[model samples]
Target: MRRSTRLSLALVLTAAAALAFGCGQQGRLTSPNDHASALSARPAFDPSSVRVVAAMASQDRATPALLALSGVVGTGTSIDAAGDPVIVVYTERARVANLPEAIDGVPTTVVVSGTVVPYARPGGGPLQMGTSTGNDLECAAGTLGCVVVKGGVDYFLSNNHVFARENAASLGERIDAPGRYDAHPICNQTPQCANLSQFQAVSFSSNNTVDCAIARPISGLNYSAAEAGGYTPASTTVAAAVGLAVKKTGRTSGLTHGTIEAINVTIRVQYTDGIATFVNQIQTPGNFIRSGDSGSLMVTETGNNPVGLCFAGGSGASFANPIGPVLQALGVAIK
Candidate 1:
C-alpha cells in the first residue's frame, strides 16, 4: 500500500536556502593542475587520483552557488569520457543554462534530477532488514535498512525520520513492523500492528552528517540481517566512490542495481520538519530507489559489503550517506 506523505519537488528546492549540515561552507575549489601537481604520477583516470579529488573539492566549493540557482538541486564530482574529473550539477528540470562550462578549471555537467525527497511510507511479516518499519505515532513507514550492533546489543537500522520521527520522537517510543501504512485497516484496530521495536538513538542536529537512527527490538522479536530477497549484506563496510556497482532491496522497489554516479555530494533534502543539506554523500542514477525505499542499505554488488544508507532521491538520481560515517556517528557496527 502507498502512503501520501511524499514531499513535492518544488518544496525541496524552496527549502534549499535553509542550509543544514554546513552545506556549501567548505573552502573554495582550487585549480585542477595545482591539485594534480601535488600528487606523484599515477595511472591516468584512476578514480582516486589527485585530479578526481581536486574535482570533488571544486564540486564542494561550487555547490552553494549552484544550489542557489533556479533549477539546481545539488552537485557532486564525476569522471568525464576522457577520464578527467568533472563537476556534476543536479537540477529539477531540463538543463539549467548559464552554468559555467568549468569551475576553477574543472568541467561541469548538468543532469536533470527532478525533486529529491525522503522515501517514507511503504512494508510486512517477520521483522527483517529491507522490510517496512516505522514509529507508531505516524501512519507512514519506511524500509528497515539493516541490522547493527551497538554496545553489544542488536538494533534495527533506518533513517531518523523513520524511527525517530525526524528527531521529534521521544526515546523509547514504540516502532512497528509492516508500518501503519502497510498495516492498513488493521493498524488502528484489534491485533494492532506488532510493536517489535523502540527508538534507541537518532541524530538530526544542525551539523549532523547522517539521516540515520537505530531501534532496539523488544524481547523475543524474530529478526534477521538478511534483506528481503534473501540478500545478506556483509558485516564489513566499504567507502563509496564513483563508478562502484551497488544494489539495495527496499519496500517500494524490491531489489535494484545501479552504479555510483558521483561521490562527495552535497544535496538538500525536504523533510516533514524542514529542509536538510547533506554533504559528502553518495549518488546513483534513478530507479535504484523510490518512495518507501528510504533506509535501504546500499552494498557492493559483488561483495555485498555495505557502502551507503539510502535516504533521498530525485527525478534522475538517488542519494545516500556513506556507511563509514553513519556507523561511526551511531557508534555501531554492521551485524
Candidate 2:
C-alpha cells in the first residue's frame, strides 16, 4: 500500500576507589564500616545541584556547545532524574503533556537543534541509520551523528532497522558507538574477547507492530553522552505549529531545517525488513530527514524543544511519532 496520507505525532556511573588499610590494625585508627553509609548520606551535590552544560546557539540557532561535535540533541527533558543523565522525548521534543519539568534552574540558550536518536525498540536499542552491510559508515547524513538515551535499567533505546538485511532476531549482537576520530571500535570482531569499553544491545525487536528496539548495555553503564561535550535527551514541552520553522540533529545530517507543513497526519512506514510496519504518524512537509537520517530529533527554532522524531521523508514530506505516545508506551517520563 503506497499512500501519501498524513497525521502526526510523536544510566549510570562507575568509579573505582582504592582503600588503604593499615597493615597493623592496632596501630591504625579507623572508623567503622559506616564509611559507606556516610557516603550515601552526603552526596556531593544535592538532587538539583548536578551541574549541566548549557551552550549558546548562534542566530543560525545552532548551539555551539551541542553542534561542536557531530551528534544528536533534540529538545528533550530530563524527567528521569537530575542525578541520572538527562531524559528526552521518546520520539518528540522538549515537553509532553504531564511530563516532568526541566531540571529546576539550569540556564538554557537558543539552540538551532539538539542531536538525537529519537526512536527505540520497546526493549531500548536505538533507531539508527546505517547500512546492514556496506561502508565503514563513519559520517552520518544529518547534523547528529549519534545520540544517547536512558531506559532506567541496563537497556538503551535505538531503532532496529539500523541493522537491516540481517535477521534482527538472528543478529542479536549489540553495537557500541564507534569512537570519534578513531580511538578504538566499541565491539571487536567475532574472534576477539568482548571489550568493556562501549555500548551494546543484548537483543533487538522490529516486528510488524513496532519499529524500535532496546539493547541492554553493561550494567551501570550510562548512555549519557554529555561527558564527551555533547548533548543528551531532556524533556521540556514547547508549543508547535504549522509553518513554524524548525531544525533537527541526526546521524546522517549534522544540522538541517524546514517548516512544519502539517500535524496529525496518520501514515504507515514499512520497517526496513518489509515484513513489519508502523501505522499512525505526525507528518511534516520538510526534507530535514532521509534514509540514513532514521533516528533524528526534530525541534522548534528557539527553545530547541524537539517536536518529533525524523523517520523517513520524500515528496517534500516527513513523518514522526509524537514524543508523548512514545514515553507512555515506554512507561517513563522525559522531563
Candidate 3:
C-alpha cells in the first residue's frame, strides 16, 4: 500500500479499535457523565488548588515571592518523603518574601532553582506508534497523541514546540501529518499531505505552565484514542504518582512505556533561543523520550488516564507538565 493509504488505514483501524474497547467511541475520550470523573482522577496535586494564587503571580505582583510563597508552579501539589501531598516553592535564592506557613494548608518547602526551558530538537526514527507534526522543520514534528474538545470544537493536542514552533510561530500556522521530514518528497508540493491549522496556543510568555498547543483539523479528518502500534488509552486520566506505570505514543519511539520517577520537580531547560524554568513537573527514568517526541502525552496504563505533557528531557530523564493545568488553561477536555 502507498504510505498515504497505509496511514489512512491506520487511522480507521484505530477508530474501530477505540469503538470496540469503549476507550473512545466516536473519537471522544470523555462523555458528559465521565468528564468530571476523568478530571478528578488526575491525582492529588490538583491545579484548582492553586488557580487563584497562580493568576495573581502571573500578573507580576512580587512574582518571585508570590510564586515561592504560594508554592505554586504549573499546579500546586508536590510530594513528601511519605509520598503524601506537599507544597514546593522554587526560587533563585534561598529566602523569598512572605514565605507562607503553608499553601492551601499543605506543608511548604523551598528549593533554589533556575529557568525551565523547552526541548525542541531530537534525532530520527522510523514512523510508527502515533501521529506526527508537519514537514516544516526536521525537529518540529512530535506526536499528535490525542484529541480534545473546546467550545464544542475538536482540537488535536501536542507540545508548543511541535505546533507553535517554540513560541516563534503565528496563529493559524499549517501543520502536516507525518511532519515535513517524515512525509514524502511530493507530500507538500502536491496537496497529498493531510494538514491542520494551528488554532490555539498557550504561549510561553502567556502561561508558561504547560508547553502545550492545539490545532484544528479539516472537517473530514480522522482521530482516535488508538495510538500507533494498536495502543488504546483509557477514556480518563489518573493522578500521577511516583512509580506509576506510564506509556506514550510518539513519532520517533512509537509506543514506549516507562515509570514515573519523581513528581513536583523544579528545573531549568535549555531551548534554542534561551532558558526557561519549569516548576512542579513530573520526571521519568531513562531516555524514554527522544527528539521529535516532545509533545507526547504521558498516561497511566490503567484506563490511560492522562498524567503529564512531555516536553523536555536529558540524562536519561524526561519531564512533563501535569495534565490538569494544561487542559484547564486550554479550555479543552480529552477525547
Candidate 4:
C-alpha cells in the first residue's frame, strides 16, 4: 500500500501485528507443532546440491537467508543447515509480550522497539534453503511467514509495504514470515485466489527510500531447509574491481547476468505509477534490476561476496543500494 524500509521498521517493532494492513496491527499466530506439521505439507528440494538465492519472502529455500533475514544482514554463504526463520521481538510486546514462551523455532530476535543497540550477527548467519515452495504475499495485514531451522524455532519477515500505513509493527500478531499466499474459500476474492496467497508477513521489511526492511520470522509457519533455486550465488572479493561479471534473480525476470558497469554511480528510480521520479541517487550496476527487482541480491563473480542489492532500474539500466546499507539497517553481519 505504501513504502518503507524492512530493517529500519524492524528496529522499531513489537505490536505491529495489529497495526498491519492499516487495520491496527493485529498480527497472526500459529503453533510450533503447526510448523512441524507444515513440513509434511511443504514442498521438497535438493538441499545437498543446489544453487542459492535470496528474496524478501518466498517459497524457494535454496539460497542463504531462506525466507529469512540475516542476523547481520549482508552477503553470507548460502548453506543448508537450518530452517524456520529468525524472529525479532521486543521485551515489552503488548499481546505477544510473553511471546517467547508461547512460540517455538530458534535463532530468535528479542531486541527492544526503540532501543538502538549494536547487534551481533548470530553464528548461523544468513540461511540457505534445503526445501522450497516459492510463494509470496502482496501487501496485507495479519499475514506473515516463518524461517525454520533443523532444530530451532522459526522467525518472521515481511514487506515494509505491508506495514507502510502503520506507525510501527505491533506485538502479538500471528504471522508467517516469508509466507506463501494460501487461497481461502471463505474470503476468496477469486474462487481460486488465496487470501494472502503463499507469501507470509513474519517480520518488518521495506521498500524504503533510504533503507529496505528485513526481519526475522517470529512465529507459526515452518521455514525448514534453506534457500535454493535456479540462480547462482555471486562469489566475490573485496575491492570493487571493474570488469567483474555478476548476475541477479528476481520475481519478474528469472536470472540475468551483467558486469560491474560502475560502482558509486548515481541512478534514478520510480516509486509509484506517477510521472515523478527520484534522480541520481548512489547506485551500483553489477546486478541491474528491472521492475519488481527491488531487494534483489547482487553479488560479485570472483568469490561471491555481496556487492549490492537491487533498488531500482531504468533506461535500460539498474541500480542498487549496496549490501552495506542492508547490514547497517539490519544491524547484522556479512560472512
Q: Highest TM-score: which candidate?
A: 1
Clashing pairs in 1: 113-315, 116-313, 121-141
Task: Write one digit per residue (lDDT tens) for candidate 3, span 1-335.
Answer: 01222222122222112221221111222222222232233343332445423532332333334544432322123334453444444444445566665654555555443221111121222222256664243223567757777777867778777777676777666666666445322223211122344434443343265778787765665445566646665657777899999888777876788999899887677776667777778999756777777778888876678898888898778888899888876888887
Please give, for residues 1-335, the per-residue lDDT of candidate 1 as tens digits. Answer: 23446422232222223221112232122222122222223224444588877776676667778878888866766555566676766666775777889999987766564554222211223556887876777767688899898878988888887877777787777877766666423233111223334333333345446888888877776677888857899998989988999999998898899999999898887776667778899999988889888989999999999999998898799999899988887888999
Name model 3 segments beyond 4 Å from true. 1-129, 135-139, 185-207
lDDT of each: 0.70, 0.35, 0.57, 0.32
Regions more than 4 Å wrong, model 1: 1-126, 186-207
Worst 10 residues of 1 by lDDT: 19-28
> For residues 1-335, what per-residue lDDT tens digits would candidate 4 score against the true structure?
11212212222221222111111111222212112222233233222332321211221222133213323211111112243333333322223322332122233333322221111111223332211111122222221111211123233222233322132344333222222221121111111111121122212233232323433443332233222334333323244445667655443353566776666563333444322232223343434554444445555654555665555566566765555544454443442
> How do the candidates rank by TM-score, highest first?
1, 3, 2, 4
Candidate with best lDDT: 1
Q: Give the TM-score of candidate 1.
A: 0.60
Give residue 116's lDDT in candidate 4 (0 to 100): 16
